[model samples]
Target: MLLVPAAHAQGPAPALPTAKPRPPAPAQPAADPAYEAARAAFEALPEAQRRAIQDSLVWTGDYNAVTAGTFGRRTYEGIVGWQRRQGVEPTGILTVRDRPALDAAGEAVRKSLRFTVQADPASGAVIGVPEKLLARKSPLPRGTRWQSTDGRVTLDTTSSPPGGTDLDALFERATAVTPERKVTYKVRKPDFLVVTGETPTGRFYIRHAAGADGIRGFTMSYDKTLTAEVDRLVIAVANSFSPFPNAAPAPEATPSATLSPGGARPGAGAPAPFAPPPLPGSVARPVATGLALGNGRVLTAAAALETCPSPLIGGAPARLTLRDPTGALALLEGGQHAQGAQPPAIRVEAPASGEALVVLGAEAKGAAVAPGTAGAGSVFAPLQPGAGGAPVLDRSGRLVGLVARFPATPRLIAGVMPPTSHALVPAGTIAAFLAQAGVAPGELAPAHPQGASLGAAAAPVLGSVVAISCGR
Candidate 1:
């Protein structure tokens, strides 16, 4: 039986009743020439300069960097911008500070471009492609059982290894340093899709190293075999590991930064959908309910808005704006903080970044906003729009640490996808599944089987699954 996701079960919804969904938009027909050109330059560049060059690429997929960027896979503009920030003239472009100290630091980042998968950097583990898993040509049959050594395959590592890479080496390396994490198989194009109120969580990934633009719009459907293959992986992995307990946060679904008031003009090739971040010690006037920030903006907790005890809703309608001390609104967007509340958020980054800022929770409106807030030592109030959470801002007016992780309440049960005895999905695992499914991994929406008892805490066994490994 197919499981359909209720709008709420998928994610936080907007305030407007007829708000449209935000995924499966049509992708630009042509966006691949970048790779070929970059590849040539990469092969010609010295090893020292190569990593810097690869890092400069603005491709959409992660694994694509592992593949295409190895040869060439970044946009010239994005690379130039990254290099300029790195303090290298490459071709003698822009420079921030001529101080030797800053120059040396920028050079170090350029030099440290390993472009390789980090092996649980703390644990000394290496993540890489599973040769055997990639060698398979045909799809596995439905109901095919795979043995798992890890009993917690559904939620954590409750499931054992399937025909993918054994993460022992990666795990051991990162064992003491970072939390244990392993990269596994993914569907190049996934069949199963998890549609939420705003975005669709598709369970697969397709690598694209050199991309000049963001994945604004795209769509796909899976064949039966591919669909089943992708399903098997999701059942076994995806959101499996709770690195920070309840840390399966997705990117915010909104638009951000474009024009600023008072003549602070946008840079060349300004991105569509923009929202600058708040300057230090300043706040944005919450307009039209919410705001966005960051080049690739961040979003605050909207679903948590309703928690505000005395939410004030009566006001003349206005263009929603995300602000900082400097005060620059990116775009006019719609957001729903809660039924009766409002959580103001905005993006400051460029649309070209192909990044999203979705926060799980924040400091209460009464507290102070910080540079970032994802770990311990932070007090987050229940995210009720306008009630409060930590403040997030990018250098230019970007809000990075956004999103509200409201406590598990009757209305927010779907917002929390606990690892079950049957399924566990992680970010990296989802990437692999997307690769296998033959679709862009992050492009797909969240997927869950219909009638599946999500209430079960632990994950299941003997089925493929995705698992996230967090630092214990």
Candidate 2:
């Protein structure tokens, strides 16, 4: 009888095909007829489908952060797609095949317009549980379905109903719910995700989901706070997680051995390389920031730009400019302003006071800009592809890197670049580089925002080795 120790959710497993979010042109008026119409159409959806969407809607917008219901917004498309999944077409220009669905969907959206607060009754705080959006299929052949629920849960594949419940707690109980077949989300191998923002409004789980390049999915960001408990269960799940009838032993890793003059100690002959042990949830927060700049320079870190260029061309100087999709000027800055110095593949420097940098963080709502201080200039979003295209920023909104490697490519997501090569170039080294390029001290004020946060600065993992039972 496992219990909900509290907590929930993970990055979306590879998302199924989704509607192409028609991003609205930037700098638009607060009210748009198209947006209102579409919204009305959605709010007016049928009660059942609307209920599913409500359950699925892990509201990510910050509380009180009023969003201009705009056309082509990613969130909008995602929401509309949810309606489509329920069999509705919602483009404003209603197609003949879409009118009936549109009329029905619009009515549902209208009737469904009501506040939904998934809360932790204990804290009275609104809560978000990860949508049972399949993180990925389990290795188990029987497959997974909701068994049953109450304060506790029970499971049997066919004998179940699909309904939304406290996903956080469900995830907690699912970790060790017995007689409940163990299920392994084999593909969700542990990886790093940076936690960008945490607030009373909500947390964000930002991740590069599956093969969907450049794009990321936003979850309620529950895992950020409940990580410790989540991870403990994740490990237990890994070991016991089995939908697989005949389990396969994880293949042996190439064992390592040091050439000690004599054969090493009793058990030291051939040992595995020191593997970076998994974090409880094998999850980490993203560096989400809102440091926006006028010139399209949304500040972030070199770590966030890890996917930009390979062997990552750092130290070598380069120039960058940020532009919004509308071709409106955002920010114009070079990677390096050195008069004659060749652009290093990477440049490390401290952001001058008042400059902007983005939080290339782990939370959802893939990266956003944050000003060094509030009310200063905000950071810009990554400029879409085009001329004078995009200029990435450091924490202080100075030029840093670019989005060279998009998710569109076949690259499997992995770790980021080392600190030295990233947007957060070291203050000490950056100071020198500035001078060498003839940049005067007074030109930019130095604000040494440590590129490292919560756990970035390397820390030791200390533990006492122990052996435990497989049946755990």
Candidate 3:
């Protein structure tokens, strides 16, 4: 699990496609009645048949025709030739009788790519995939992932974040791709967003929609040379795509390595009086901030768990519990004593964009608090390293969010670029995470406008926050 902002970040899978959506166009002038009618009738045909018609026209030497489902001047001229070839009078329009023959001809062209329908029970995404080309498939964080053996094609399905994702955020991620010669097309309706473009790597298509079930969509990419055939295959996948209840079993809990009175040992029932081994080189053992909830439950950033074999809170060993695979939240158990006295009364409250807030676990002298502001899904605090799991509080000391590092655009200083800044997981995300874990938070109300000094406001909550350390 990763702790980056779920609203903007793609799911946990490393190879999944990211999208940057484009702006919607303004309303256009009304079209001629006759042209509009013909366009509508053309669009009414199956997308496959329309594309097939377009390809047939191109194959028959109508090089100016684009396969898009529209009946423009070039397309009309191409249809005339097709009509003449079918022994019908050249009306420059296709009729019901001509649809089948067009499809049959299109099918003949697509036969070179043997396609098969594959059902992903885990994510409930059933799509027509080119089994002959892509022989490897795997399950991803929120969907299924597939790739061709030769690495030419890739496909993925994605699920929306917990509190729902803003369409603008989704659009921004999709359009970030770059190439010297790039072309993009975007469509935004009341319910869904589609972004497709050609980058240096390949032709990419991304679709995102928020329905009653949640935000769900798919992405596909192929070598530029495979555009025509790949277009047909993806159309079939889109038409058949659907989601059902996720039926995969939950993963078993990971055992926390326990420390003995003598020394350190792996798991339970082990002899003591030995030093613990170092954590694997792959995982980073960074110091992080942690928040104390009641009943030995502590909440922190998921990034902190990436390599910590045994995570420590206030010098006491803590147990790993539930974590959100799609966002930056993790729930821990058995560390209430680390907070000193009773766990501080923590409450959830949403803060305004520029609300006066203090970050508790930030590296500061004495009772000092690092000042910051609330962003869309995170906080904008210039926190020191190791503040990943700190608590964010309002002037009155109510919990507003958890401090976590999130992806930010890089900035250049002198001649080199610096890393993105850290942010807080907003209260809305905290609420959704705890709700899923069946933990009810205490009543929290917005604080009154305040004028207290930073130290005075932060002192009360500082005692309840602790720095987390990790080891093998």
Candidate 3 local accuracy as lDDT? Answer: 0.53
Q: Runs in model 1 with CA error above 4 Å?
A: 1-40, 46-75, 86-159, 162-186, 189-472
Candidate 1 vs 2: which has more lDDT: 2
Per-candidate Cα lDDT values, in order, are: 0.23, 0.25, 0.53
Candidate 1 per-residue lDDT, tens place, 97-121, comes to 4233333543353334222222222
Q: List the candidate 2 regions with Cα displacement exceeding 4 Å.
A: 1-121, 127-433, 440-452, 455-472
Identify the candidate with maximal lDDT. 3
- Which window of 10 residues has the lowest lDDT sum in candidate 3? 1-10
Candidate 2 lDDT over residue span 173-223, tens digit each: 333323423322101111112122234422222211111011111222222
| Model 2 lDDT on a 0 to 1 scale | 0.25
CA shift of 447, model 3, Å: 18
Query: Model 3: number of clashes?
Result: 12
List the candidates ranked by lDDT, beginning with the highest: 3, 2, 1
